[model samples]
Target: MNGSLRTILAASIAAMAMTGVARAADVPIVPYVEPVPVGGWYLRGYIGMSNQQLGKLDNVLFTPGTVEFLDSGGFDAAPIYGIGVGYEFNEWFRADLTGEYRGKASFTALDRYDFNGDNIWDGSNDYSANKYEWLLMANAYVDLGTWWGITPYVGGGIGASRNTISNFQDINTPNGGVAYAPSASKWNFAWALHAGAGWEVTQNVTVDLGYRYVDLGDGETGDIVGYNGLNTVNNPMIFDSLTSHDVHLGVRYAFQ
Candidate 1:
């Protein structure tokens, strides 16, 4: 009686253990991972071209005792490039602090003048120089909603620039004269308005192509002198309302 009872109890316990092991193996085990969201710091680099203009030039008439003058003056196109670090505050907002090197431009003015209102001698002079600037700006932008992987944007910047004038020369053919203005540099208040679209090529990279209208204030030269019979000692030559129309192409690398 004792052996039969003990054997039956042991067999029942073994059967229950095997059943529990089978049930445990059949249950699935998978790890749960949360998805990450987007928004982070970025680095940007840009290269562009500027079509520049000199609004007005003065001090050309100082030597002729009220030398009345007529002139055509302008600045040539040049290249500009910059690097920046920025933050994407969200899908709709961003900002950057950038420093740029604006390439040199050729400046020329064809001056037609009469000394003392004399019709006897009508003469002309050409003034030339190379101008360049270094700019630092803080810019903020709004990225409109993306359409077809491209986002339209609008923005503005406020900054300062060091405008430099170099290689200043004056040539007068009629009077067989030559003159020079001292090359100089000036600090000016600068601002810009930007507009364009950005194409999101991948999750962490974007390409931006856009336009900017920048007002670089004014630029000037030191003093001047004329050779031969032409007028020499004059006030500093002024280039007022200096502005540029710029087109930019840039790339951004974003970090998460």
Candidate 2:
């Protein structure tokens, strides 16, 4: 072959080989994404702590011609458990239906009454009273995503509650001291409002903390009269309205 032709052919072959190598390098061998399932229905179970307080009431009992007294401090703390069904609307928002059970919480109070206008005291005056309550609820929520690993949310619901009063003891009084014993249980309609946030510890598991305020309607406390071997006096009374402020910490699992 002529020198000039040989040199041109050799240079052409070298360039073609270089181009093949460059094309192969530009083609990616692995994709750059992860697979995640986004929307679905999920069920969550939770348990946490709660604190409750009861509101004040007047003329608790309609005891004619006498004054009634109730202990103002009816606050308690206990464990709470619940289950919920939820729907994920997107990455930022979701809604849920929840119901919770709170164990029995109780407190004691004293009730006293004046029977007659007699200057000489003679009546059964003192009695001991006990109170307790339970709650059920449902709510909706908004997930605020995450900062480090924490997610925040808010929700509300309506439910029913039961209040009970028992264990009455008669107190000594002048006017031949009257013996009075009273106990009753009542169910009432109620509602709850709550706001809280949680932390995702893993892809499918979360730890949540929150606060809720609830209102349980008023109940009736019947007239008090003598029971067993005690003097009798009938005075009407009503149970006051109830409320609670609860702080809770719990765990949740998401099916992804």
Query: How accurate locally, in lDDT, is each candidate?
Result: 0.87, 0.66
**Cα shift from native, residue 79, model 1 (Å):** 0.7
What TM-score does candidate 1 get on C-alpha atoms?
A: 0.80
Point to the candidate with the largest TM-score.
1
TM-score, cand. 2 vs. native: 0.70
**Candidate 2 deviant stretches above 4 angstroms:** 1-30, 57-70, 111-134, 168-185, 221-223, 228-237
How well does each candidate superpose onto the true structure, as a TM-score?
0.80, 0.70
Q: In lDDT terms, how accurate is model 2?
A: 0.66
lDDT of 2 by residue, 202-249 (tens): 877778788888887765455656555532445544557777777777
Runs off by more than 4 Å, candidate 1: 1-36, 60-71, 119-122, 227-234
Instruction: Return the top candidate by lDDT.
Output: 1
lDDT of 1: 0.87
